[model samples]
Target: MDRLFRSRRSTVYSTKGIVSSTQPLANAAGTKILEKGGNAVDACIAVAAALAVTEPASTGIGGDCFALYYSAKEKKVFGLNGTGRSASKMSIDWLKKNHPQHIMPNLRFKSESVFKVTVPGAVAGWCDALGKWGSGKVTLADCLQPSIELSENGFPLSQCSADIWQGEVERLLQMNEKDENLKLFLPSEDWSAPKTGDVIINKPFAETLKKIAKGGKDGFYSGEIARSIVKELNKRGHPMTTQDFSNHTSTFVEPICYSFLDHKLWEIPPNGSGIVALLTLGLIDSLNRNGTIELKSMKHNSVEYLHLIIECLKISFRDSDQAVSDYEYFKKKFEADFHSDAEQLLSSKKYFDSRSSLFHPDHAITNKEMKEGVPNDMFKSDTVYFTATDSEGNACSFINSVYHGFGSCIIVPEHGFALHNRGGNFNLNPKSNNCLEGNKRPYHTIIPGMITTESTTNPAADEEELYATYGIMGGYNQPQAHVQVYLNMILFGMDPQEALDASRISLFAHPEHKKLSDRGEGSDGPSSNDITCVGVEDDLDPDVVEGH
Candidate 1:
C-alpha cells in the first residue's frame, strides 16, 4: 500500500517555520504571525482565531480547545485542557425532573437544546496559551487582528467550508426562532447558506473579537459577552449563570506518553480520548512482541491487517467509553477506589497486555464479548486540528471545535457565534464516571498530538527533541486517524503528506442500526447485540474489502 499510494501534495519543508491547516486563509494568518517573529504558540493562536471566521461551520471562539506544545528550550511537552464545565446549577437529577423525555441509554441532547450549552472555553484557552508559551513579541490583540479584519472586511468563503455550511443549512434553520443571530450565517436573500466565493462579513463577531483582544480573557468571560451568554441561555429556560462563565479555567497537565519505534507519542490524557490511540498502539505493540501478529510482514490494508486494527480500535473504544471522563472525577475515583491515577493506569504495559490477550487473529470480537478491561474503566466531537513549527524548534499541536456543525445552533445575535453543545455528551446515570454533574467537564474529543525522541548527544541526560506536531480533526475519527498516520510514517516510511493522505479504516457503531437486535423503526434503546462497523476509504483494495 505504501508503494501504491500517492499524495496530491508533496511533503512541505521549511527552515524558518511552517503552519498547516484546512483553510488557506487560516494558514496565511498563521504564517503572517510567524513572519512577524512570533513563535509556534503565537502562530497557532492566530490560526485558531482565523479559522473561527473562515470555517464557522467547524470551529469558533464559542467552543473548546486543547493544545500540546513542545518547548525547544525546555526539551519537554506541555498540555492544556481548555474544555468548559457544565453549569453549576444543572445536574442529572435536575435534568431528569425537567426533561424526562430525553432519558435514554447513550442519550445525546438535541443540538438546539439550551441545556446542552456549556460555558465557552476557547477564549480562555487561547489567552492562557499566549500568556504561558507566547514569544512575547506579539500580544493577544496582534494574534487576533487577522481574524477581526477578515470578519469585519469580509472574506470569500472557501469551497470546502461552503460545502460544509450548506450541509448544515437545515440544522441552522431549525434553530430557535428567537435566535436572530442565525441571520449572520444565512446571508442570502432567501435565508439560505452562503455559497462558495461569497464574501461573508461578520461585523458583530468582529466586534466580539476586538473586545477579547483588548481585555484578554476577561473580555469574553466576565464582560458584556458573558452577560449576553447568560441572558440568552436563561431566556431558553437553561440554568446557566454569569458565574459559570466567569469560573471557566483551562488546566495545564503533563502529557502522557507511549514508546513506539524508538520515539514517544505524547497525548493529553483521559478526558481528551487520546488514551484510545495510546492503548491501540500499546495493544499492537504487545501483540507484535508476543508473536501474536507481525505487522510489518503483512500488507497494509490487507484483510488480516484491517481486521486486526479494527478489533484493536474497538477494544480501545470500549475501554475508553467506560473510563474516560472529567480528569477530576477520574482522579477521585481511581485514587480512592483503585489507588492509581489515569496516566499511570492507562499507560501500564500489564493493562495493555491484559486487553490485547482478548484479540484472536482469525475471529472478530462481538460487542457483547468486549467488556471494559478490569484494570481500568473509562470516554465525538467535531473539531479543527492544525500544527505549527517555529524557527526556534518549538512546535505546537492545537485543536479547536464547536462540537457538532453549527454547535448547538443557538446563535448569540450580539456575539455572532453559536454556543457549543458539549453538555450533550454527559451521561445521565449517576453511577457512571461521566455522569452529568455541576461544574464538571464532560468527556472531551479534541486532542493535540506531539512526537519526541531522546536526544542523541545527551542520551544519559534524558534530554528530548521535537519530532512532530500533528493531529486529524473529526469527532471519533481523530484517534483512529492518529494511529494510522503515525504508523504510515514509522512502519511504511511515508513522508508527512503521504502519511496523512494514505487510506485508513475507522471502527464505530452503525448510526442507523445501532443494535443488531433492534433493526426496525422506533428502536432507539440499547441492546445486547450492538453492531460495530468498519469504515474504509473508497480507494482501499477491492479484494481487501471483500476479504474483510
Candidate 2:
C-alpha cells in the first residue's frame, strides 16, 4: 500500500462525500451542494446542471438523462429513465417522405431543419430524481444557483473545451457552407473560439436556468421556455409542438441486476446499453472462475487479458446491436423470455463453461467461428457521466447526453440551448423493435451503473451498505469502459482513482466481419485471425505490446 503512492493520481478518499466528473467546475458545484447539507440526489442534480454550463459541447438541457440512485434509507437502488421521445406527431411516413435515405443528411442543421431532434428530457429527469430521492433539505432553486450564476456571469473556458468547440465549428462550417448557427456558441461577435482561460457567458441560458429554478420542472417543460422551444423548432421545418414538451415525463423503473462474485451490479434496462457492461463482466467472471483464463496472475493489459476482454466485448456488442431497443417495444416482444435467457447467460455456470471451452489461450477465434448465444444481447462527445456519494451512504450514478456533439446545433433562439439528436439513434426498418415511432424513446447509449456489496445472511440486508457510484461517458465506450474499470479494481485490486486513471482498451468489429444478423448457424463470427483491430493505449508494458 505504501509503495502504491508512486502513482501520480491517487484514489480520492472522502467520508463526507465525493463527486467525480470530467470537468473540474462541475465537481466543485456538486461539492458545494454537499457543503450546503444537501444529500446525494441534490448533489447529483446540481452537478448535472453545472455540467450543462461548463461542458456545453457534450451535454445540456436539450439532452436526455438516466440515473441509478442508491438510497441509504431504503437500501435499494432506483433506476430513472429520463430519456425523451420523438415529437408526438413524428412517424415513419414522415421519414420516408422527408429523408428518403433513412438518414439525417446534415446532422449539424439548425433545430428547425434537424429531423433527429427529440424533446430534451434532462430537466424532467432531474426533477423526478429529486422529487423521489432527494433529502428534502434543499429546494430545487437552491440546488441550481451555482449553474445559473455560471451561465449568466460566465466561466473561463478550459483548453479542451476551446479545442472541441473550434473543431465542431470548423466541421459545421465546412458542411453547411454558411455561418447560420455558429454565432450562438462563439464567445464573441468575431465568431472565434475562446482561448483557454477566457471568460464566456450565455445570458439567455442563465435566464432559462433561473426560470427552471423558480418554477421547477414546469419551468422548462411548460409556459415561456416550452413555447420558445417549440416555436423555434417548428419554424426550422421540424414541427414540434408545446404538447410534446408538456407531456414528457421520466419513468422510475426496476433496475436490471447482475451478481458478480460477492457484489451485485445494477443498471437501467433496455434503450440504454448498461446491459452490455453486465454481460461483458459476467463473461469475464465466468472465464476466470472456470480457469479458462486466470486474470489475477496476468499483468495489466497483457495480450492474454486484452484478447479475452476484447473477445467478450465482441459477443456483448453483437447481442446489443441486434436485441437492444426501446424497453416498451422489447418487452412487448420478448417479455419474460429475455430475462430467463439473460439469467442463463449471466448466472448459469454451466452455460458459460461451455462457451469458455471455445477460446484458445494462444490463438484467436474468428467472428465467423464465434458461436451465438441463446436469445439475448445487450456517443462520442455525445454524453456526460458523473458520480456523487453522500455521508448518509446514499449514492447517485448519473449520465446525460444529447447523442452527438453540439446536438442538433440548433440553439433555440429564445432559450439558448441546442436540441439533442437522440432520435437519430432510431432506425427506419419497420421490422426492427427500435424503429422510430411518435412519442417513442429511441435506442439509447447513455447508462449509469452502481455496484453494492452483497449481504451474507439475508438478501434484504444488501441495501444498507452503499458501495460505489461510477460510469464512463463517450457513446459506445460506455459499456466497454465499464468492464475495464470494474476489472481494474475488482480483479486487479487497484484503488478507485487508480482504476479510473488506468489505461483503457477497446475492440472494434473486424471490417470484413458481416453483421451478426447476416450470419447463419455455424457461420464464422467477428474475427479473422488472432490479431484483431484492437486499440490499446501505449502506456502498457513492453512485453504486452511485443506479445500482441
List the candidates' TM-scores in order: 0.94, 0.87
Candidate 1 ranges with C-alpha deviation above 4 Å: 1-7, 105-107, 178-180, 329-340, 376-381, 513-529
Worst 10 residues of 2 by lDDT: 520-529
> After aligning candidate 2 to the native by TM-score, how far in Å is the CA of 25 from where it should be?
2.1
Task: Indicate the worst ten consecutive residues by lDDT in candidate 1.
Answer: 519-528
* Alpha-carbon RMSD of each model: 3.8, 5.2
lDDT of 1 by residue, 360-456 (tens): 9988887776665746433214678988999999999999999888788888867888888877767665766666788888777787898889998
Count of clashing residue pairs in every prediction? 6, 10
Model 1 residue 449 distance off true place after TM-score fit, in angstroms: 0.8
In terms of TM-score, which candidate is strongest?
A: 1
